[model samples]
Target: MSSSSKIRVIVVDDSALVRSLLAEIINRQPDMQCIGTANDPLVAREMIREMNPDVITLDVEMPRMDGIDFLGRLMRLRPMPVVMISTLTERGAEVTMRALELGAVDFVAKPRVGLASGLNELAAQIVDKIRVAAVAQVRRAPAASAGAIVHPHAGGAAAAAPVAASPLLGRLSTEKLVAIGASTGGTEAIREVLVHLPADAPAIVITQHMPPGFTTSFAARLNSLCQITVKEAVQGERILPGHAYIAPGGRQFALAKSGANYVAVVDDGPPVNRHKPSVEVLFKSVAAHVGRNAVGIMLTGMGADGAAAMREMKDAGSYNYVQDEASCIVFGMPREAIAHGAADEVLPLAQIAPALVARLRGAGDRVHHRI
Candidate 1:
């Protein structure tokens, strides 16, 4: 590719080896070119000003400033797509989530120190994320004063009647369950959607691309923060209302009907979409077991892993939704589903939860009134 066509990137890390390795991997890509490397946030700031790169790969732990602090400053000052490099630990995951909320695009788990064991895996993920980060839309945070808040019923008694029944006020039903699948940038994206759901939101089953030991902690953390219950799924466990279950990493989780209730069936299966806990696997199971009763959602992620399976559910008369391209860190999966005519609706992150509730309650007509 020509210089103008190449995706220019800046690599920021304290480690010289990591910097070199990342630069080498990025340069090897036909569409990517490394513009510069920075050892810390101070240098990174100057490099960003001088190089004006399209994307940045930043290390979470740095000498002068931590990645999270730098990310906040960067977002407020100069917004650009940033992919965080973090260690594979509970603390790292927590910090990574914070970075995403601060405006970083995505994250890649750094390899553990062991020759031949960790480096190979880390290299693959780093390269994949860099490619996706290049195409991601990086937007600056909106100014706090941009919008005016209209006080409900503050105008007069007549205004109070309509205000009392705002369109946004809708009840959530627990009789229906939602099954979601996502990968790459999913950790933060899923959190954004789940956090906004009401306490009585439909039961949720999530199959995110993750490894063993991570899902448990991720679920626990989400449970603590959200009103609805959240936990990692176990084999033969019945799905319940007002709770969310995350499929354990490294195992395929499928939904099976047991009389009147649904149960999660965990099994060691071959990797689909190059992922053991594949979204396709879970969505397919949901399509077969729940049919029209399930609401299937495919979120932001790389590859078309869940698109086909989401289509299967749509064909079975289930309500299906995909994240719109503008809000996605990577639009691959959702785009695929939308292109295949599988999604009943393509919604932004903010609209998904509310739309979900409306669909479950057979209130689509009322929901369409707002659109």
Candidate 2:
């Protein structure tokens, strides 16, 4: 964060042009410097030994050794933050998710075409991701294996039980909605929260900053791991209990009440706070439509995208929770919500899912009381 301590970065890609352009963008930052570039894993392995960079930008696919394999080895051997540069395709998104599971800090999608022109459009994003990566905590691979990585927020098996009785679980409980917003490190954060939820939890909605072609895979990934169904939001679909809808990337998703039931409304809109599926947009919609019947959650991210709207939700009588700084990969979103007096409670990641269950079960009024 200081001027003297620059964020040392390394760019690893097979393309000469990409390496050069990435180096240029990284060097342009006042607080960052690209110390080295490598065309393949072999070269990167040797360069890493000498440079010892604070962060790495890796291409998703490479000759000889793919990015996923190399990332696994790197995290196992010498844990450090890594940001993946992946193609904008379904395959790329799936691979990027694997990289995250292998300890990647984040990822940026490569332009579909026009390499030079697209890279120019992504200059700010590339630099910002690098800065965030530099500050991220890179955990070493688990002792069991590199593939055994689990999110820090995931709770044990007991978290899967449904609350027997509660104020929100009566005949009127279907009207309740749980709205969640996250970015940066949110994919895993959301997964951690979702996997612990019971199959009968209230309807949940999520907005995680991501590019086109990624949200479907993300939703599928969660659906496979969680007890509840998870799917990408479709316009006009009725919101139902035990299901989680993820906002499609590159579009705005909002909640709209149709008489007694709520439905997802998806539309093309200009980016809000520089994100298409901005957390602010979703939170604002929930505050307006669901009011006190909603529960707002602000999770790990790199920006204050949802802080003001979260406050609006709180002012409308809805209780809200934020992930605490110590458990977050980056504490920007939750920290901002806390600063704005938007959060009712700041909880560790491992406690948030269970706390939500307790609140909906009517026990939260006595336990995990609002600060």
Candidate 3:
């Protein structure tokens, strides 16, 4: 491809080695090129104004300006796709979550082990995310006060308590299960859905594509904001109403029935569709075990990983929903599910949770897909 046709990129990091490694990896891709490198957000700001690259790989920590703070500024002043490069520490994961809410496209966890070897091992992932970010729909965020730290659902459960307390869902809550799958923009999308569900809502099981060491923080982050209890799925635990179980990163999570109650099955299995905690695995189990008592949700993501399996869910008598194009960061997964004749309703990101809750309460119309 010609240089002009390539996806222009900027690398922003404090570490010289990381910057060099990322530049090399990006330049090696035929469809992308590293146009510049910045050691901090200040330099990056100048490069961005001059070059206006298609995407930027940003480090989560840096001098002169904190990465999250910079990202909030950039999104408000000049919105564009950004993929964060972060250390896989508990703190890093928390910051990464904040970055995503600030409108970053995605993130790559810098492995805790060998620096050079670890980055080399993630070459495919690094490039793949850049490709996704290139065409992703980006929006400017509302500007925040200087020195103010913005967090998703800043009010926590204390602020979320009265928002979704449904007294109408009684026996229906215990009888049904909600199966959800997402990737790419899933972090914010999943949060949008879970926060709208009441504490008495049906059991929700989710699979969001992520590497190990991230989901624990992800689940905890959600738990603080949503009315329903949220946690990483535990093996053989009875699935309870009003709780959401997130598939552990790097592991498979599926639904099963033990005697009179539903339980979670988590284990190390071969990667399905190149993802361990694949949506396909979780949706399929919901099809086999929950059957007509299940509701399937396919959110914003970048592949067809769960499309076919979600069709199995529809065939098995589950009502399903997929996020519509306008709200998706990458429409690949939802488009595929629509092509496969799955989704019963195609709703926007903000509408999905309310719609799902209505369906469970037997109050919504199903106006809905082929992959």
Highest lDDT against the true fold, candidate: 3
Clashes of 3: 10
In terms of lDDT, which candidate is stronger, 2 or 3? 3
Residues forming the 10-long window of minimal summed lDDT in candidate 3: 362-371
Q: Candidate 2, which segments miss by more than 4 Å at Cα? A: 1-4, 143-149, 152-170, 363-371
Residue 174 miss distance in model 3 (angstroms) = 1.3
- Total clashes in model 1, counting residue pairs 3 or more apart in sequence or in different chains: 0
Predicted candidate 1 versus true structure: per-residue lDDT over 1-371, tens digit per residue: 79899989999999898888888888887888999999999999999998899899999989879888898778767878899988777888777766765667777777567623465556777777777887776766432232222111111111111111123224324346788988766775677667656666667899998776577777877787566789999899888876899989889988888897889889998899898799999999888888877888898888888888999999987889899887777788999988878899899765776677555545534545566
Estimate, for each residue in 279-306, the C-alpha lDDT of model 3 and write its tens digit: 9999989999988888999988999989
Go through the candidates in order and give each one's C-alpha lDDT.
0.76, 0.86, 0.88
Residue 168: error of model 3 in Å? 3.4
- Highest TM-score: give the candidate number: 3
lDDT of prediction 1: 0.76
Work out candidate 3's RMSD over C-alphas.
4.9
